[model samples]
Target: MALLITKRCINCDMCEPECPNQAISMGDEIYQIDADRCTECVGHYDTPTCQQVCPIDNTIIIDPQHIEAREALWEKFVVMHHPV
Candidate 1:
């Protein structure tokens, strides 16, 4: 599943640089995750890098609207990084 930056985000600017998929970007008020590019770091890390780097607990959570299984996420990752 993709991740969502909640209102609790402090805009610390930590997550944007840590996202291996480059999915996080500055939004109007906080960082936003591009669901199409977000694979929860499946191809890069064991856990979501944004979640790991976020200072505020629960600031980054699963995107309920873009819910996806692990296999789906892996496929997305492969398509994005492998591109073969």
Candidate 2:
């Protein structure tokens, strides 16, 4: 699933750089994750890099509305980084 940065984010600037897909960015008030570019680190790591490094608890959580299967996440990863 794509990740969502909650309002609890402290803007520590940790999650943005850790995102393998470049999915995290500064929003109007907090960090935001781009659903289209997020692959949950499927092609790059065993876990989501942003979530792993996030200092604030519950700051990064799965977007329930944008949930995806492992296969779908893998496909997204390939299409994003290995586009034709």
Candidate lDDT scores, in order, read 0.93, 0.93
Lowest summed lDDT across 10 adjacent residues in model 2 is found at 50-59
lDDT per residue, candidate 2, 2-22, as tens digits?
999999999999989988899
TM-scores of the models, in the given order?
A: 0.96, 0.96
Candidate 2, position 74, lDDT: 99
Residue pairs in steric clash, candidate 1? none
- Candidate 1, 1-84: lDDT as tens digits: 899999999999999999989999999888899999999999888889889989899999999999999999999988988897
How many backbone clashes does every candidate have? 0, 0
Q: For candidate 1, which ten residues in a row score worst on lDDT?
A: 43-52
Compared with the true structure, the alpha-carbon lDDT of candidate 1 equals: 0.93
